[model samples]
Target: MSERNYRAAIIGTGAIAHAHARALQDAAGRVSLVAVADVDAGRAGEFAAGYGRARAYGSAEELLRAEELDFVHLCTPPRLHAPLAVTCLEAGVTALVEKPPTLSLAEFDTLIEAERRTGAYVATVLQHRFGPGAVRLRRLQEAGELGRTLLATCATQWYRDEAYYAVPWRGTWESEGGGPTMGHGIHQFDLLLSVLGPWSEITAVAGRQARSVETEDVSMALVTFENGALAAVVNSVVSPRQTSELRFDCERGTVEVEHLYGYTDDDWTVTPAPGHEDVQALWVKDRSEESSGHASWLAAVLDALDQGQAPPVTTADARRTMEFIAALYASAFTGERVRSGQITADSPFAQRMDGTGARWRNA
Candidate 1:
């Protein structure tokens, strides 16, 4: 481990920033929470006072200009993620941004370019991928212990009532990105992509089933992985009984996890086929206690920084997840199957998740 103790700041004093503060606190000796920024000065001051010695700034620009930070946790809105990250990158500070890192694929690409221009990095917080259960599952899959992955299902069925959308940025395409697919389900499906690898194609449908929002509250997609595995994905904010679940059926056995939000190893189950009973031992061996959340992910990010390597959830890796979201939207809107890499920089989908405008926008 490097001898240097990193100094960090949080750029948005929202609910999510509390998670970042806790994670930074968990890394007490290794990383310090130095400052926090928010458009609302009073809110920022209150948050800063609660998080130890962190100073408060009225704006991200003020924080960046005054504080010398190793990295900034960008818990800002979707639209601010890219620009704020770019600002951090330009300042030679790494940025750890929350989910729906950017409002558009084009914005994400800008981050990639900014990273190249500056040696600093941008890491998206897709915390689900860092959970111990997910780590073990990925290890087994990579070792071919999971056998040929045959079929899978990933769902993020969570309830978000009308009151929840009262937060101005909660459901709009421009500010929040695409509804459940981008905001809520992106976490579950991102874990799905991390485990299953690159996707080959996507055909999807999205609808405004409930809530009067500028975006679809529900979406469903059929995804084909490069490994020839087919999966069904459902993202919805209208479910009465909320749950995030993923099941993978392979030649050897099936691995499943059912939980809401974050999960620990207990949330996972591994069943070996009749002749593959030995696989159960592999699943339980060297299990991790870390749950899927900001703390676990923050640990990994710090590890990367210490080694002078790019952090977990690197922009390239996140780009794949973002591209998948883009393609899902493209397919849902155009009524056509969208292939991986099909949403080129020229594609409108790259400019915004809604692309040429969501069908519901005109309706």
Candidate 2:
């Protein structure tokens, strides 16, 4: 259990698989990439070749059966995440699943069930929260430098060229689970929810404005937080410059964070309330090196495994983020406000998310 060295496996050999590999390497003495598995033997072999002394498997089942892994990094598409993750946990391997844990609420529930049954620690990779800018923002909030937060807004406008969605499962509801909202927006929303707790209700609309995908390439949502703070989220794959930004309006000041997915500089200002000159003295310049977000989170996963504890981001916590998306879809289609608590196992929308529908036809 010493942090000096630990063994880990990666479940998928896709693009994100390389990111996980880098994270393992980044941890250096603390952890090592022990093995890798992919549905395609060629890809698995290629991945194994890049990392030093890694065993390769043609599939996850084979890898799990043959090797002892301290943790598994799952980089498969959204739909395949649950079953594979459960398999790892049930087999006594810890896991760090990529963003947007699963395709639907039901799948997320199964992940939780598997965790309960096995006591395997499963963490969701919402790496944005690890950014230095975000850390600074949290410190400010904790110190009450921002005062009462009234509203927050996040926008992710990034281009996904035709070739980007050319892959069979790229833009589909069945595999990838919708468009940028689930793919790109999930990261920003993760940070939002991390700072501001669970939302009370959400109303949203999604449409296919540009892409050939069955699901919407553009989506918008209006959220009412449990703390009564208002929020708006917009995600699109049609924009040109690829802008990621967040703005907060608070009683004493305003803070704006720029750069959609990477490290960013947070610009903030303070306006003291009347007769509060002494409080103004607390303000200080906030600046720090941006984080290689996902790498930082993966390091935490390794540390957690070494200590026999749960990572900061857990499967149950991720389920709520998925519920936020499900509730948004329900409200959009029904033309009624949707409460997060209303999306239980017995909810009407629960059965319809079969991971396949007209929404995936174009994708």
Candidate 3:
């Protein structure tokens, strides 16, 4: 690890920014939060004051011009993610963007191009992948200890009242992206992909359901991975019995985690097949205690920077998750199974999650 300390800043002082602030605090000696920016200058000032010595700026442009930073955490709304990340990349600063990294794959591709041009990286914050249990599971799966992943189920079912969508950006296709599938469940399903490897195709359905919003309040999909592992995915913001859960039934055993938002080692349970009880020892061997959240994820990001390598949740990795999302929307709206790499630059879905407007919106 590099001995030199790194300086970072945050753009947008929202509820999520507090999580980023805590992560920076967790990194105390390694990374410092030097600045913060927001359209609401007062909010920015208050956030900076609460955090530490970070100076406040009225806008991201002002911060980028005035501060020399190693990177910036973008906690802005979904629509601003791509542009802010691109601005950071152009400024030769890495961007650690919150999830649904971009509103669309096309926007994410632009960031990828900017990285190629500027040699600055943009990493998405899919923190679940860094959790101790998730990390251990991936390690085991890669070592072929879990055996072949046969079937999996991933779901993010949480309730959001009508007041939740009252926020200007909350339920819109143009701002927050595609309801729960993009904003909420992406974390769980992204972790699923990290463990299962590349996905091959998706058949899905979405409905406006009960929410009086422009986007679907519920969506479900059948996913096929390249390794022949199948997964059933469900994303919803309308369920009263709230939970985020993922279960993988492997050839050797079953591994599962159930939690809302974040998880720790305790949230995971591993069951070995009748004769494969020995693998249980391997599961607990050398397991990390770190929980899934911004802190652990940021630690990995700093480590990558220390070694002069691109950070975790790289654009390519993020793209897979993003592509799956796009494919879900395509499948849901078009009523057809969508394959991986099927939505090209020419595809409307590439330009926007809803493509040519959602069917419900048209109706």
Candidate 4:
């Protein structure tokens, strides 16, 4: 990495933009915030002024055209991620986009095409993978400390009021893609995918039980991993009491994390079985302390760029996560066990999440 600061810019000054700005600020002397943009001119100007002495633009196109940046952090809605990242790649600038990188596999392929043609890298913001807690678990499992992963569970149950969905792109298929699974639970589920690696098949169900929206408000799936491990996954936006949790039952014992949005060391707990108490000591020995969030992900992305390597959560890895999402929706709506590769480019589910485009037409 160069001793001199690498220039960085931010697009979209929404809630997530603030987190990106703070991460940049937290990065201190490593990266310099060069510019920021939003459709709302005032928001862009304010974000730039508050974060750094960055120039502000009214749109991402303007931001890209005017700056010579090393990378751009895309904090936009799900619908715009593909095109915006494609624009960045085409301009020879790398892109770090938020999770559920695109609406569908077909859409993600467009970004892949642009990347191959442009020679610029595109990384998805699956921040949970970069966290210390999960990192520790991955290392232990690889060393045969945790033994084989036997059973795992991920649940993202949170509440959203009417006003929350009132935003133009809240819970629509055309805009935000899918509901809890795509938008909310994505962080936790992506973390699950990282731990288990590739998935094989899924049988799932989804429904729009409470929210008056176009997509499912809740979903449940049984995922089979390549290593012969099984998982039960649930995503919900209508729960009254919200919690984000993941539990891994390995050959030694069980390792779990319980938190709402983000987590720290306190939220993680490891239990060793009767004969494998050493697993608990190894877990407490040494690992990163930084909680998973925008800052940690940004650090990894910046470090990768400095080393002239592709950053974390590359498109191909992110595809597996997105494919799992598509398969779940396909299985839920079509009443079939959707295999990992079943949602292909020609699959109707790949075009639109509903497959048959029946449910939530008016949601």
Once superposed on the true structure, which residue ranges of model 3 sit more than 4 Å away at CA? none
Candidate 2 TM-score, true structure as reference: 0.90
Task: List ranges where model 2 is wrong by over 4 Å.
Answer: 1-4, 264-286, 352-363
Q: What is the C-alpha lDDT of each candidate?
A: 0.93, 0.78, 0.93, 0.89
After superposition of all CA atoms, the RMSD between model 3 and the true structure is 0.9
Clashes of 1: 0
Model 1 Cα lDDT, one tens digit per residue, 32-133: 999999999999999999989899999999999999899999998888998999999999999999998999999899999999999999999999999999
TM-score of 1: 0.98
The CA lDDT at 215 in model 1 is 95
RMSD of each: 0.9, 3.0, 0.9, 1.3
Candidate 3 lDDT, tens digit per residue, 1-363? 688789999999999999999999999999999999999999999999999889999999999999999999999999999999999999999999998899998988999999999999999999999998988898888899888999999999999999988889989988987899999999999999999899999999999999999999999999999999999999999999999999999989999999998998888888999999978898888766678999999999999998889999999999999999999999999999999989999999999999977888967
Query: Model 2 scores what on Cα lDDT?
Result: 0.78
Model 3 residue 59 distance off true place after TM-score fit, in angstroms = 0.7
lDDT of 3: 0.93
How many backbone clashes can be found in candidate 3? Answer: 0
Off by over 4 Å in 1: none
Q: Itemize residue pairs with steric clashes in candidate 1.
A: none
lDDT per residue (tens digit) for residues 1-363 in model 4: 657687999898889888888888899899989999889999999988897699999999988888999889999888999999999998999999986689887898888889899999999998888888988889888888888999999999999978899999888889988889889999999999999989999999998898888888999999999999999999998998999999999999899999998888778999998999998889988855688888888888878877888998898988888888889999998889988788889998888777776465654
